[model samples]
Target: MNINLLKLDFKNIRDFRELTIPLFKEKDVNTPFHISLIQMPNGTGKTTAINLLRSIVCGEILEKEIVLSYQPTRYKCDEGYFGVLLIIDRDLYSLGMHFDYRNGVMKYETSRPKEVGGGKSFSYDLPPYIRNVMTKNFTRLFVFDGEFSENILDNKKTEAETSIKFLYFLDRLELLKIKADTLLENKRKSTKDTKVHTQQGLTKLETEEKKLKQTLVDLNKQLKKFKEESVSTSQEIEDLEKKNDELLSENETIQAEFIEFTTKISSLENDIRNGTNIILNILRTPSQFSLKMNDKLKNLSENMSKLKLPRSVSSEFFKELSDEDECICGRPILNDSIKKKILEKAEQYLAADHITTTNCIKGSIRNMDDYKELSNLRDNLYSYINEKQQLIQAKDLLKLRLDEKDQEKAEKIKQEIIRLSSNLVDLNLYIQSLETKNSAFQEEFSLNEYENINLCQKKLIEKRKRLDEASDTVNFSNGVSLFKKMMDNIISSSIDKIKEDLISKSNTRISQLMGNKDVVLEKIEGCIYVDGKKGVSQGQSLAVAYAFLSTLFEDSPHKVPFIVDSPVGSLDLKVRREVSDLIPKLFAQLIVFIISSERNGFVEGIGKYEDVQFLTIYKDERETGSIAFHTDKKFFMQFHSENEEVQV
Candidate 1:
């Protein structure tokens, strides 16, 4: 379950005419070094290498344009190659991608372990478990760049949630549920007529079911469209607002006031976001929201304590009692009848596992005593709302002054802002309607049941159930339904458990890297959210992302390499040192693609570790091929790109 990169080779691909970068030191393939820092100056094929690595692992089907993009510019060549050697769990494997630029075709080949006769296959021949989950989305989790940090925080991207599901094999459980649904549908189809229902009734039910299924499909498509449109509209509004701000700043008379207002507004927004996070956290526990619930929990705890509930008698005790000829009280249990009765009663007692779960629940309920935090959170929420309103009024006043200074341009910008804001509002409302669950008595046109995914799904399930009943496949349908419900519950509970554990571990790492507890990760829905800010700096984002990934992969059965481009380029000196200190211990193999500029503090920090291998790759004088320099720390520290070309 541990995968290490052994070597990466390229031929006629990008700037690399021929290259073999050994990821290990002293030719020790059995135990690769923990860190491999490949210093490639800007545009020397760092991105190409990263992309090819992802494509190889994920078995990505290359587009025509992408295939041609890999052709080297140095010479005329119709073919190119990129290959990676990997050691997975002590087994050697190599994956190669053959590119034919003339035909815009890319073919993959993999070599198996020596035990399997060591033959090459013209396909991705990864182990079953690894291949099953090595999706493009999952591969991007480890084989990524600095932009991954920002992507993990975007609300519209499900990278965070999808990674968790895939890593934990929750997606597999979902697939099982889908299989169960398929089985039920097949059973319904096979049973066309039942003892109680005629063929006509069954046919009518089937028609209705088909209609409902189609309705669900259409509703889902509409939902996806709305969600996508919402993201684009939000971006448009943000861009327009930035343009307006720039326009306002151009006027000398209002520039100073505008800058002051912008700062204050930004600060207030952060405050509001933080306050909302705190309130949401406090509200998660219902006892904190109501004094009555708190009292009830307290009373339950007291009663359980008085009654000696979760009694000392365990199933094991009963089991032992039944096994003995005489009872613990010295009663004569030589009779077979007595032993049988005792054995029968054993099932009524709590088992060890149940007792442990009960104790955990009791402890949680016993600890719910304070409601003051909720009251304070409510007050803070109100304060933030009032402050936001004040900031809005101040911004409006500033806009008024700008309008007087330059009416024509100001009015144009103002009108555009107004229009975009209105559109954004409508988009948000529509998104909400699609997500909302409609009640039976709700007006049809206000929010149609078919328009909402939740409601439409409910209707589909009901129709399917009726069809199953009419077709006399009730037993199979019920079994499948129960199985689906069990899977759904497990998925939900697993997500919650993993999220809690990940948040705790990630926050600890974040605190260490940031040197304080100022940055708190409040939740992980589609992405990671900080306690009081809408956005974090690039450095913080990277730190947060690495912390999250490290925690996620800590206990995974598969230990994969972490390949990154410019791992510490965006961070400051202090953060770079912290990251360098923390990242090496988190992964089994770390491959970093860096430029000379990032070597100041980061290289020194990680270079202190003896297990690091440093190498530099740069373009040759003619810019036709790349040159690789295998160097020690001294040389790596002194090396800088002489090519005056700007880094992309």
Candidate 2:
């Protein structure tokens, strides 16, 4: 699958009243220019263009506020339009979004190839494969801005993992598993409701399953809402603290003490957060945290080794022997008593499924390290708790001093802070309770199985098994289970391979970009991280991000255009040149939104390519619209914004 950008059109949107910029060369619609550089100054529609491109490709629903934000500022406009023309594997398509500012409504329109004669439709009419692959998350990978560089490195974000899953079709495999589950469910529903007692059992189980499913859904929604509220509340608290600091700036004596306490409290809070993360990571491996579990696992492993639990001969061997005409000692097994005895003894050995499970457990236990880490884990947990206690004390002392200086204002702020803090604590505790898995020591924490996703899923599976047995669809259920397991194994191995390859390729490119700088990509779990570094400069971050994304898209089956805003604006001269030279070769088409400030080294490097198109667009000072000038490299390099403002 190949997607090439041909042109973009805008009307009554942002700074552009009417505009069209060709993304390809003259007399070419089938093939896009290798490099199409569009230079736009600050206050122009560069950001709006990027957003519209993403919306068109992914068919995202526009919020009411977002739709109104695109209205033209120069004059009254009732509506606006943004359209994108592209070719997907030789088929021409045009996607358009019409925004009604009055009603806060946005409608989509799609035009297919002339051969199909499907004039215009008020919906996205893309092919199934294209729709499936061009998800919002995937679209953001190609159509993005410099902020994405920071997002790719943030540990809380899953941008790197999501890109791999979507680009490599692992998400599709997951969807197939979901479909299998749905099919099995339909089979259960279609079973004959013959016996009243058995039907009642199935009904009860189905009702319980539905209730559990709804509970899971509600819990997920609450989790998302709480997370959003957490971020907003934290920001609000920070803003209020800054305001308090400004109020205290009038009194030097008190201000100095306040600043000192604030700084220490902030430091302690950060330390607590980091410590909590570390403890959570340790808890993910329960055996490393509990001595009792460690000893039990070790004992189990040793006993399995001694007893040869899986055994050298399985029950299948005995069953085959029972079917033989004679015994191994040359005795006549034609005797019915001898065959019956052999068959009866076969039940004593492990079946194939049991053997496989035993082997897996044995391997897992054998691979675990000795219980030395338990002590270290305990120490870490203690240190984290100590830090948390210190943080609370510091916050309380700060409030006390604030109350001494200004009672009325400080009292109000302190009360608000306390309320917010309590809310945050409750949210955090609930989130942890919902996310934690069941363990042997769950009772110690009074963990409820119904509140936890993992435990609820386990109960759901058990109920499903009972229903399957009642419906006499055990064979079908087993087949679906096996298929799901196979898919899981394939997806896991594929992701592992992709992660290994991406890390190697990204590090190679990072080295090339950084030269002698010791920037090595150490891992790509939820996000990309550098070796032995807490953070990198903005330039280095951008370089690392480009390296990662270029490698990610290099071998993908879909050849989508790389459309980026300020691709090299944050980069230094050397990194800008490196990125410019490397990025064009990794994608089918490159459409970069740049301001005049990024033209020093980036334009020179990219201009070296033969198939490059340069164009400049900006707001017209005398008119109520914008102007698009089809220019050469000379004009593009020299042009500057009239206001001399730099786009961030």
Candidate 3:
């Protein structure tokens, strides 16, 4: 499919309102597939016409909806493609593109919501014909302002590539390979991390396991020594009992005589018996002592008793005073001796061997009496009287056991511990060496597992070699021609001819882009540069650039209509005549914007040529809008006659 016609359907388009704007005159079948025009006013929608042409070819403005005098193929290129013309304005206002084509459909979806903060914009859904042709090719052609000359060229490359990518060039081989190469680099990094992490974990595990096994071996040796030393302590205890027996025999003889004397009155009397013995014997005599003396001995015995007392302070006070004084409630005793009487009563019920005696008893006390019974009535007492010596022997043997029985065992345990510890140190060092060996083995094993790394490295080296070879023009014809082909895709051979033909024709028509400065159409390398090495003024630059672009479309692949707004405002007298004649001869269809000031020159130029049409723009008063009309010789003549009457 290709575009057949372009309809200018803006919110307020005056001349083209619902017009099936045929791109060519009805009878001009052999018209050139190009156009040229000159605009005589400054802000007269000259650039707008170019942008609308691009929008139409892009299927932004649907072709089928508009009339076509000649059907434009909607899907295929009638000619190869279209190009852009860049007018330098800091605000980018003068930028414009023009496209020519036909056929099928290309579709696009974009939405600009009615957002609040930014300038409102509307969008068009492109047809598939546009998407197919635009997405694949014909995207790189451009013209630059050429003010900074080389810089503009460089900057345009970037902008052109950006537009192509946004147009979906990445679906093609070039951008696809770029994405794949990025993924390949990421995969290489991931594989490297995986190998490093696995190797690190494996090395740590092997080292720790080796250390643990060596610790277990050292513990086994320690257990062996612990068993042997603990078994020898029993023998040392047996020797202690034998030394106690001999001392026991000598103590029994002396103890027998003492027991015999204890039984006889005179014999026992000659001895200062244990005070306990004397008191107990005296008490057995009974009636000889008064209650006072008996009480004194009882008191002495209780005082001397080794029984532990309760730790209560009230208990101690009650013990000394009995519950005898004041009835314990602070009331005076009815009888003055009542405290003494309560004491006598508590003493009567006192624990046995608590000698607060109301009566005396002989050989009958609590724990003191139990001590004597333990002696077996002096039989074993005498037998064990030198028991201290026996005890000393047993104690000395225990001392020997402390120093010798467990001592030899402990010393052997110490030696065995030392030997085992020394063995452990050697084992530990060996284990360390083994651990180091394991780490080395694991490191080697891991390295072997990732042998692909080496392969990849080798592959990368090979790739670099290939890329280097391919990238060098000396090595490959394709590489040598890569830049040339890229340029060809960017601009067709027709554009180059445009330079020669348009500049040549322009020099013929406009006497070159200078006044009395003899100039020639020159090619510098592949590009056309003006003969003036020094730069021209902004006006001359504009004139030349416009001529350059107009000439570029002269031999275009298909018929293109030209519409220019303000073209003669900056031109000198000679250049104006040249442009005036140049337009109709060079282009097939031409619509120009003009002011009253340049009308005479334009009329003279139009008269100079045979066929041309000029359109007039007016703000219509009654309609409250703009109106477009054609001005002819009869209308001008009528206006001239009316003005003459008003003057008369």
Candidate 4:
């Protein structure tokens, strides 16, 4: 519904002892202008006019002192009041209030014409919907500054959504949802505390669950450590076994080498002994036999020289002739003296032969150099024996050392290997025991954990059921608050579609205004986007804001005038023109509060539109008083105790 301003009459209003303001003449009231440009200078009762109009439309009670102070000293010691007449949807209504400053009391009254009031007038009888229509939040939509416009356009602002909701009356629905949520939360808390389980039991269970979780975590850590240690021990055993195998192979090679060396030493010792014995016997026999042979040769020479008569005969031949008793003359002399002489002659011949031969052999043996050659051979054999013995001793020592090392170290290694195997067995046994224990613990923990979770979940489910029942009761108690929340959800679900349409329409308006689509407006996750980014300039921001308001108004089921103060003042020339042109089409009656600086741009943009009023506020030169001027105007102005008419 369009709220058309009719007239405002006041006694003792600010800066006026009495004042009457006519928004439209009697003739124009029937043909109200769709647009009106109220040109008001700085601080000339324009703000007061807005406040009084809001009070009249929304039944706001003003303070007596504040109302009296409007006329300065006119009613400082007395009572004062203001009255407003409005034509809403072709129906006439009057809202008036009287202030008693001395008594600090105020009285508000409203009247509908007898024709529309069913033959009875009700004081302050504004309909609830109409009363709801003009609120602080909704007022900002119609009456706001550049800051509000900026907030409306800001993508990051929370108020943007709030303003939209307020404008569309969605805030009421959201408020219901909030109340339902609060009730549900309270019900949940009450159910959790008082249903299915005691608070103490729940707390104790939670604490136990925490401890069990911690214990499980610690056990898992220990299990990991133990497993790692087992792997490490196994690896160590494998490495040691491999090393022991290498050592065993090395020991076998050493033993084999030692045996081979010992065999060679033994052969060398036999050779040394045989060589030494043979050479020593030769040395002893040769030296002793040489002396004996020399003595024997001298004796033979002396005996043979004493007895020899012939040089060719030997002693054996002479002895044989004496035994035969015959001589070479063949004479058989029987006399003893003859036989003896013959025998003696033969012996002497044989002995002389023997002496000569023996001396010749001795001379040849002395020239042969046998003793020097034998001595040299014995010395060489002795040297060779000594070298062989030394070599044998070295071999023996080497064999002994090898045996010692092999025995000593092999035994130690074998013992260690045995001990390592035993230790490995022990570790395996211990690890097995630990694993068994770990398994038992894991099984126990699993069971405990399952039971704990199951019990908690069961209790929680039971409590949640109770809470649901309680919430239903609360909703019943609160009268369809739950239904309203469900409706909110349903509405919320469809908001995306609404937002899509809003985005489409807003972009259309922006495109029409700016003559380009460079700043494509979109909404994502409840935020405005300017070409997929945020924070446009003030002009662009205002353009976006205008587009949003246009969309909101177009979509709203209610019809209301667009009352704005300096709506496009913050905009640049081009944007101001676009906004000025676009706003006229959005609202049936566009009431703009503009100063002189803003007038030319709006007039050039929208002055050609029919039924547009250009009302200028005329301030007295003293600047202490002001009045609105219109060609067709009539109103009541009351003096201290009288009524009058002030018109221009």
Q: How many steric clashes does model 4 contain?
A: 11
By the TM-score metric, which is better: model 3 or model 4? 4
Q: Candidate 4 versus the native: TM-score?
A: 0.48
Q: How should the candidates be ordered by TM-score, best one leading?
A: 1, 2, 4, 3
lDDT of 4 by residue, 214-250 (tens): 5545545555666676677667767765554455445
Question: Could you tell me which residue pairs clash in candidate 2?
Answer: none
lDDT of each: 0.80, 0.78, 0.38, 0.60
Please give the lDDT score for candidate 1. 0.80
State residue 6's C-alpha deviation in candidate 4, in Å: 3.5
Let me know the TM-score candidate 1 reaches against the reference structure. Answer: 0.53
Better of 1 and 3 by TM-score: 1
What order do you get sorting by lDDT, best first?
Answer: 1, 2, 4, 3
**How many clashes does each candidate structure show, in the order listed?**
1, 0, 35, 11
Segments of candidate 4 deviating more than 4 angstroms: 61-77, 118-123, 177-495, 512-519, 524-528, 531-540, 621-648
TM-score of each: 0.53, 0.52, 0.34, 0.48
Residue-level lDDT tens digits of model 1 in 1-648 = 788889898988987788998886676766778899999888888999999999899889899899999997767889999999888878889999999999999998999987866889998888787787788877888998867766777888877888899888888898999899888777667664443245576788789789878888887788788788878877887887777778778778778987887888788788878978877776788887778888888888889899777877888888888888789899878888888888789888899888888888899997664874567767877887787688667765666666555666667767887887788788777777777765642345466557777777887787777777776666566677789999999998999999999999888877876677766777899888766254555455556767888889886777899999888765677677766776776677899998888776787779778888888877777555756656676777778876533222
What is the lDDT for 34 in model 3? 34
Model 3, 223-292: lDDT tens digits are: 4444343333323332332333223222444334433333342333334245345445645543323455
